[model samples]
Target: MTTLPTTIKRLVNHGPEDYRLETAALPQPGERELLVKIGACGICASDFHCYHGAPMFWGNETFPRYVKTPVVAGHEFYGEVVAAGPGAEEHFGVAPGDRAIAEQIVPCDKCRFCRSGQYWMCEKHDIYGFQAQDADGGMADYMLFKPTSRVHKIPQSLSLEECALIEPFACSVHAVNRASIEFNDVVVLAGAGTLGLGMVQAIRLKTPKKLIVIDTMPHRLALAKQLGADEVLNALDEDVVARVKAMTEGYGCDVYIEATGNPAAVNQGLQMVRKLGRFVEFSVFSRETSVDWSIIGDRKELDIRGAHLGPGCYETVIDLFHRGLMTAEGIVTHKFSLDNWQEAFKTFGTPEAVKVLLVPEAE
Candidate 1:
């Protein structure tokens, strides 16, 4: 076996706009743990929010504080297995040289949620890149998978770019599954970013009556249409709620999915979704979203669902990608070296960049 490097270049989130790139000691795998050489890691919107000190991640009155100080920042990642600890190869059914990805959440098996099979919402809540010790992220040259990690091997046929995208798309799959979309339901998806575009493709397979995607940017709206959305609405130029209602004969859409991190979209979704509609919210907001409760309880009586991370959907995503049901074509718009993280992070969610990546080394 080749000797591991002595140090690595990593990005650590110190707080809002305080991310510092530093050379850190390399992490070694323990029993049942695996060390991987990161191929690529995508800068997610939540990562950007975390950098800007979002209340949800930094914690506030409503949500408990999450980020432990000075943790490496990144989670949408995949890499090749370089070294495996005792029994890791047998346990994970993977060997050195195989590409693999781990679920974002590293569950505490002792938690009620974990024991009940809902590990995604584990009481411990250790998501990679935020929780310092157990889940250090992949914005570095290498990353380690803990014994408790839920890991899956990637197929060699998939490109390095697509392999890195599986995490976000898996998240997309989970959020779409939460909508309970019906064949005849008119579904409205807000946000044309990474997750939103993926949702467009996934929702198409469900074959909704009509899929209307909303975004403020024209480029993203175009991409959403290209990805299979029946129609695209520019929230910047259109009275989205009014337009969606008019299309549904004043009844509004039957299913509404919110992927835009903006708070205003939350209020708009409540208005555009018909009474008894299913509303699935999948954004990590930078600020608290204030919405009218009566619209949810007294007026509309909607089935509201919140999607967290990708859970029980990685394999389905792999299958989808393998079968060509999904593609990252128009989504991944930018790539930067590990040393150029600042620019890559700044490019995140930009009108021109749907998904920005940090490649450890060029393929």
Candidate 2:
């Protein structure tokens, strides 16, 4: 095992937009736990939301706070195993020098949701990076994987960025799975960001009749096409609802998946999905997203569904990456050293960037 450091670098979140790059005592692996060297951690949209003090993270009168203060803020991540505790080697299927990733949620295992095999919606709801004491995030030199963590081994053949991207892609896989698409159904994916682009390819594998992707940025739309989108629409220059309706002979799309965090996409999806059609939402919004409920009940009778964290889909995504079924080329567009986390977070979700990663060893 490598000699461990007494103190290591980490960015600790102290309220809104207040993350300090500082040193802290290094963590050690306990029984069935793991000590890992940070590889690359992807910055998620939720991180951006937390940074901006979204009520979901910071709390408001109506919504309970999710993020615990003084926490380590990152969930989309992976690392190299530096040491494995007793029983961890067999459980995680990894040892020193091996790479691995854990599911974002560290299930309590006794909760109602967890007991029912729906651990993603654990009542305790302690996800990595949000509850520092329970599961600190990977935006640091080293991090600990709790014993309750559901672990997966990462293939060495995959690129660091590809490995880091597994979390989001697994989420994309889950969202696509939620759509339950039929072979002949027309699918519309709103937003061509990392999540939406990922859905394009995943949805394509289902062989949808036509896959239309919408985004304002031309580059993202173009990349979506290469990723398997049959048709790409520039929402800036075209009427997305009209175009989709026209293409579908006025019935609207059969499946509409909203990956865009924008509130407008909610109503847009409602208007573009055919009556009794499926609507899947997988965005982490910082603010309220209001839409007319009558459109869901009185007018369309749409089947509304929400996709949460990646569940039972990580292994499939890993195999996909190994077989060249997936690529992070256009999706992972920016990398900044861990110390420059501010710039990394700032550059995320911009028009020119699709995904931004933080490399702990870069500095």
Candidate 3:
């Protein structure tokens, strides 16, 4: 039997910009539980937002003390199953030495939503890295998967970097499915960042009549083209609504999916999508987004949908990776050792970086 370490290093969030690299006792696995040795953890936009004291995470003056402090900070990660407590194999069918990943949210199986099969919106809403009621997070040398946590086995053929992308790729797949693209529909995807780029590839699999990508970053837009986007538009150089209208002969796109965290992209999608078109919003905004409601109700009659955490989509993403349909090229931009987490955050704040990952053992 492989002996487990007694303690491990982890990045713990104390408050806004108040994170510490500390050593703590390793979490012990219980019945039907799993201990994972983390390989890679991708930094998400919400992680950056939390680092900067966003009201959604840090809470505002009116409602302070939202996030659970001193919690480990990461949700997008993949690791090897180092230890499994009794009944783990019978419950989750996972064994030691297997590569595995769990969804970000851990449902309270007793909640009505969970019992009814809508567990993604469980009432408890305890997401890893943000709350400690369930599992902490994967931002450490090792972490635990709670009994109720949904776990999936990953193929060893995938690189650590590719495995780190499974979470966001699953989100992309959910967003694309939420869009409900038609065979001859013109689809517009806003923001060619990590999630948007992944959506570009996922949308291509639908074989839409046109897959248009919009982004201010030329490099990301170029990558969108390489990912099978039918047309790439530079939002900085042209009037996006006008250009999109011209392409659609003033009909606008049939479907619009917003992946950019910027609030302005929400209005842009409103302007570029046709009346009665479907719009999918997937970003985790740092602030309240105000837009014209009349556009949706009176003018467009749009079918607005919100895509949250990767619910019921992890398997499809893994299958996509297995078939070589999804590639990590141009999406995962940088890797940093856990010691250089500050530098990784700085790089991720810049527009140039697409996806930044932290590897515990990276040199």
Candidate 4:
């Protein structure tokens, strides 16, 4: 075994226009945890929000100074177990060299919310990329996985690179599952980026009546059609609300998915959702904005739901990916090494890239 070092490679975000690669210390594993060597880590847009300090963070009020300093960031990842603490070996039934995806949030099992199975609502939650001080995240070569955290074994057939995408795909699974989309239910999806494309795949399993995808980007719209969207609408040229209404015979879609964090799209979702239809906010908007609540409540009676992250959908998604139900390669457009994280992050913002992933040094 390689002698564990005190520092690990990480991407540190001091502030906007202030991201740099640096080496940080590998955290010491606790009694009920294991040290994992990261193989891959998917760069999420949330990391962009943190890097730029745009959305201000959940605990921005508490830690004022650190916001300007370097903060280690990265959430979506897959790793191999290198060293296991006493209890973790018995719990996960995995040892050194076993591959696994660590849960973003390590729920405090003692909390009532956690005990009730709503672990996402746990007050004392330790987010892998965010809150935990001692729990250094996957941007490093190694990090600690708490015993209570959800850790699923990656299937033998699946590659470690693909495992990095399971988290986002799982997010789509959770959103679609919550939307209760049934067979032949007419659906209209907004945005054709990574999440939007993933939703298209998830909706296909239900065999929707006609999946209409709306996006301003032609490239993304084309990708959406490739993913089984029956119809694609260019939001820029065509009148989106009018086109959608025309397609559904003026009834509007049964389900409207607002995957773009744009405020205008949120209102558009309200307008496109049929009376008593479901509108799910699958995207996260950091800034506060105004919307037509009266139209939503009185006129449409729309069932709007906010999906934060995949709570328990990772295992199912991984299974689907392995069984050929989910396609990871199509969605993954660009790859970069940990040292080239800036390039990866830049590609993610580009119009051509769909899902940009950062390959770990170990891989």
Candidate 5:
């Protein structure tokens, strides 16, 4: 085998409006790990947060944050197995030529969180594509995944383009798991973007009584309707909370999913949920924002839940996408290659692009 180059393409943030795609060194795969050649990586909103050095949890200094300058910034990706270190082949069931997707987090199995199966809460946890823990990341040509870190083989029926969405879709699945929505329960999803759309499809599997999607853009709202939303509320024209209450007969929705990452929307979601209802915060807020606590805990006695990265939902999400049960084609209206990554980023700021995918080195 030819020796790989020491450096790879990585996005570095020097300052505001000063992002650089620099050549960083490739990392080695350790025991019980596999080296992967990144096929395609999706540019997440968190990438933008990292670029701006915003107030995201990953950037919060109070916690042992992982986000730093001169770091690669992408987690949503699919790739091919290039090399499997000792024990990895047996552990992951992947060979050199197999197509696979890397799970972003690798928790410490010894932690109480991992012992309880809530590995996402591991104290020594590290986030892929954000910090160079044991891998370079998918923004580059390759990444490394340990056996304990989640990885899934891709289905042949699913196009590589479709596979790129699995990471975010798994996030959707995590939210669904957190909400634990029951059959025929009224669900109000606040946002019609990528994460929002994923919530729509996952909620459908439960056959919700009503699935209301709210967004400022009519185009996105229309797309939500196409994705099986029972009702689409244009926040630009109507009071979202009021409309949601109207749909639920003044009882408000049984569940409210806040996925827009907007602080105001968080409060709106909190206000729109029924008494004893569950509220899932799935959005990555750009900064720390305030909300009404009384409406959240006292009056409603709401079960406010937080859902982050997927711990076990990656394969399930891929299966759903492969089966044509969940599709973002309507939301994935725009596409760009790695060379035009800047254009893709620009498009994400527009209402035109719902789920802008960065097709890096794709055929």
Candidate 6:
């Protein structure tokens, strides 16, 4: 076993664009808890929004602020279990040396939502990296997995790059599952970002008649094609709704999934989906998105479903990774040491970057 250190470096978020790298005492495993040594942590779109002082992160109209400052800031990560407190192995079915990843939210298992098997919407709603009382996130050398955390053991053969992507991939799986696509359905995915690309791959498995990806960036559109998108449309260069309508015989796409955080995509999805089609929304927006409610109710009678964190989908994502159905190639575009987080954050959301990751340990 590697000798554990008494102190470790971690990124602490004080507020929007007010984070700093600081050394803190190493976390000790409490009862039914585990000490995990973080290997890699992926920067999410929500992380970028928080960094830029988006109203959603800072609090504004339509939604109350959720981020609690002075908390460590990373949720999509995987690591090795270094130590386990008593009963942790029996409770979490994990032990020292095992590779594991925890779901982003640590639900209050006693809540009504939890009792009803909807823990993702637990009334307490404590997600890592945002809530201080929940376990601190994995943007550090080490982090803690609380007893209430939803932990999953992952295969060691998977690369750290693949492991870091599991979180977002699970989310995409949930989004795809929510759509409940049929064999002959024509599906349209908006925005070929990390989550959008993952959705393309996951939705392809359902054997949709046509899987179309829309994005402003040609590079991302090319990647979407490689990932099993039957058709790729440059929303910037083409009238996406017209192109989709032309392909679908003017009926529009059978399903439209909005993965882009941009509010404009909401209207695009509303416009492109056929009447009575399913529209799944999977992004955490930075601000309020105003759209015509009639598009959902009277105009189309569309089944608009909201997808939150990856609930009941993590195991499926890991299994898909093991079966080689999902991959990280060309998706995880950049890596940086934890020391270069500032530069990494800047690179994220840029045209050149897809999934940016921070490696805690030097390779």
What would the TM-scores of all predictions be? 0.97, 0.98, 0.98, 0.92, 0.91, 0.98
Every candidate's CA RMSD:
1.3, 1.0, 1.2, 2.6, 2.4, 1.0
| lDDT for each residue of candidate 2 in 111-182, tens digit (9 for 90 to 100) | 999999999999998999899688789888889999989999998899987898999999999999999999
Candidate 6 lDDT over 2-39, as tens digits, reads 89999998988899899899999999998999999998
Q: Report how far residue 292 has shifted in candidate 5, in Å.
A: 2.1
- Give the runs in model 2 whose Cα sits over 4 Å from its true position: none
What tens-digit string does per-residue lDDT give for candidate 4 at 27-131? 666787988888888877777666656544533453333232445667788888888887887787777778888778778889999999999767776667765
Residue 266, model 3: lDDT of 98
Predicted structure 6: lDDT: 0.91
Better of 2 and 5 by lDDT: 2
Model 6 is weakest, by summed lDDT over 10 consecutive residues, at 127-136
Structure candidate 6, residue pairs in collision? none
Q: After best superposition, candidate 1 residue 323: deviation in angstroms? A: 0.6
Off by over 4 Å in 3: 61-65
lDDT string for model 5 (1-363, tens) is 746677666555555456667765676677888888777787788876666666563445655456644456677878888888888988988888889987777677788899998888887776776655543457667777866777789967887667888888899889988898888799989988888888889888889888899889888888889989989988879788888887778999999888887888888887889999999988887778798898877798999899988868988888898788988577666767666767777877586777777665643
Better of 1 and 4 by TM-score: 1
Clashing pairs in 3: none
| lDDT by residue (tens digit), candidate 1, 1-363 | 767899999888888889999998888889999999999999998898888878888788777788997788899999989999999999888889899999998888998999999999999888899988878999999999988899999998888768878999999999999998889999999998888988999999999999999999999999989999998999878799999999999999999999998999999999999999999999987877799999999998999999988898999989889999999887888999988887887788666898899998843
State residue 274's C-alpha deviation in candidate 3, in Å.
0.4
Q: Give the TM-score of candidate 1.
A: 0.97
